[model samples]
Target: MAPLIVNEIISPDTNLLIAFLIGIGFGFVLEGSGFSSSRKLAGMFYGYDTTVLKVFFTAAITAMVGMLFFSLFGWIDLDFVYINPTYITSAIVGGVVMGVGFIMGGFCPGTAFCAISIGKLDALAFIGGLTLGIVFFTEGYPLFEEMYKANYLGTPTMNELLDIPRGVFALGLILMAFAMFWVGEWAEKKFPREEY
Candidate 1:
């Protein structure tokens, strides 16, 4: 049975410790993959390096398939999984903001932290700006609260929303990820960038 914490098989402190260890490993992988470089990260948008796309796509597919198999094998309880509630308006706005920030800063939050660990000054600035953005958002929460809560789409899984079986949805996503990887490889060749 998975979700040991939810099932009360593991204490909350142990769960948190596990999460911290996983986070360290994940950060190490990110840094090893050259995610600490702002130019490399920004290359995703420039069509010069598609490694970012491939890495993230592969991760998504892996997680999706892993969870599907886990559920099928009764190793994990799907009902114990948490799905974040969808706030359509806030989601759209947040995506746009994050996209813009990614382009300008050349690092998402996770990657920024990775860069900071490697002593990147640019990443330090990015973190400062990110902190300011967070402060601004929190201070202005009351003003944005209405817009944030506008679209109240209750938590719904993709398969449930599309009225398809989980296996079918996972299959479709895996196929799509393959196609995207093909395109990404082609783009990298078409828009080649110097080694970082």
Candidate 2:
């Protein structure tokens, strides 16, 4: 199929179908992994349950390594993939705000939706707040637009910034994931709690 769907080889219907299937699988896995519970999700912050940490770290490493391998084997066209333009300071601030929100809400947007599917009232309230926040941000974009565009760093991969081989970065990431997994395990044992 000419390496990638970005080449317009796949029909729109097929592309969307593939996305729908993948989304369903992702949601199912999350729900099965106890991520649909606010208590369990919050447990990670409390060091009582580290399933969230392990699952997410594994997923990230897997995706990164898979992408690297795919690029190496000519399975996909990396150039056709969309990359977000990096605004260094704004990006750091945005990520901090996002982390704080996640800690407060006990559910990131994706898990909030998963919890809502399972009839969690807290998730419903979270969704309402998220919608309101989005509306406010859209309405007030002009006020923050300058700051949003302040740091105009072009999108560059780790290899580009660190001047290291892509494989080296990938290896370092995998090692870091493993180290964190070990810490997560220890945390779970140190603060063991019955399943929610």
Candidate 3:
């Protein structure tokens, strides 16, 4: 009858090894989930298929609920978990850029890597573009540094920022996801297309 100690259980090297193993599993799942196919991924935007939405939302909810449950039961110390700081302006700008990239490239970072590993030519091109983009960013970091650091909103969770309980936000997200799923289901029927 002992509680689970999930934080920093091993040395950094061991943690990295675990990360590698987890990454392998993640890559396997992505490939198996048809994320390696640009056409399938692109179908999300065109309303042809919503596998991406389903998978992404399912994963998010699962992680959210699991974390909540774990913290409730004191199995994991929630304080040790890293939450991203809310940089409102930069977050919005970066997300918009990434959204455009997703639509244009048909591959986010993880999926692009998985596709590249599977010998996808388009994914390879995307990777090249990503590398060039990173290089450009680094080279022009000086010029963009000010804008990047302009919005200095320290790490504030939704609960902190909105003065609402975390559970309320989680519940809201779940409801919104359900609504989107309903729409996706309708769209799938309304515009059935041959799958790639």
Candidate 4:
């Protein structure tokens, strides 16, 4: 169905409408999960909660497994999937910045949007700061363009770089998620706190 969008089987307007609808559903789910609360989000860092980590790992594993099965059944063509280009330097820099922002603000961009919809004043401010940062990046693009484009590693995946079959990596990922879930559950017990 994704290729249908690229092949124009779905018109641009319909594609956009679909995206909007999906976004709404996603936002609703996030809000329902208590992700819109900054304190709950920040609790993960203090080890008082592990819902975020558990949910993230579960979702990742589910998607990986689902994709593998879908491809095996010929329900979806994996060949048409887009791979994100790996820019090592920029990725590290961006990740570090976002990590700090996540720790301090207790919300990533998506959660901030979800919070905003539920009338969070702090989330609104965070969104404003995020907007300003974007504007600054746009205005100062010339200064950062060189660093941004540096360390291009093409659209590489572990299966490609490691000389292994995709199934091997997917299996490893499932195992890793299980291990992480074990550790997360332990941490939640070890650092139990009254609910925020």
Specify the highest-TM-score model's number.
Answer: 1
In candidate 2, position 96 carries an lDDT of 87
User: What is the overall TM-score of model 4 with all chains considered together?
Assistant: 0.93
Task: Tell me which residue pairs clash in candidate 3.
Answer: none
Once model 1 is optimally superposed onto the true structure by TM-score, how far is the C-alpha of residue 48 displaced, in angstroms?
0.7
Please provide, for model 4 over 1-196, each residue's C-alpha lDDT reduced to its tens digit, 9 standing for 90 to 100: 4655765678878878988999999898789889999988998898888888887788788888888898898766777788888899989999998889999999999999999998999999989988998999899999998999899999888888988998999988889888988888898899999876
lDDT of 3 at 130: 88
Clashes of each: 0, 0, 0, 0
Candidate closer to the true structure by TM-score (higher is better), 2 or 3? 2
- The CA lDDT at 77 in model 4 is 77
**Tens digits of per-residue lDDT for model 1 on 1-196?**
2376777878988888888999999999999999999999999999999889999998898998898888888777889887889999999999999999999999999999999998999999999999999999999999999999988989999899999999999899988988999999899999998887
lDDT of 2 by residue, 5-76 (tens): 676778777887888999999999999999988888889999998889999988988988888888888877
lDDT by residue for model 3 (70-188), tens: 88987777777776776677778888988898999999999999999999999999999889989998999998877777788887776777888889988988998999899999888
| Overall lDDT per candidate, in order of appearance | 0.93, 0.87, 0.85, 0.87
Greater TM-score among 1 and 4 belongs to 1
Q: Candidate 4 clashing pairs?
A: none
| Angstrom error at residue 40, model 1 | 0.8
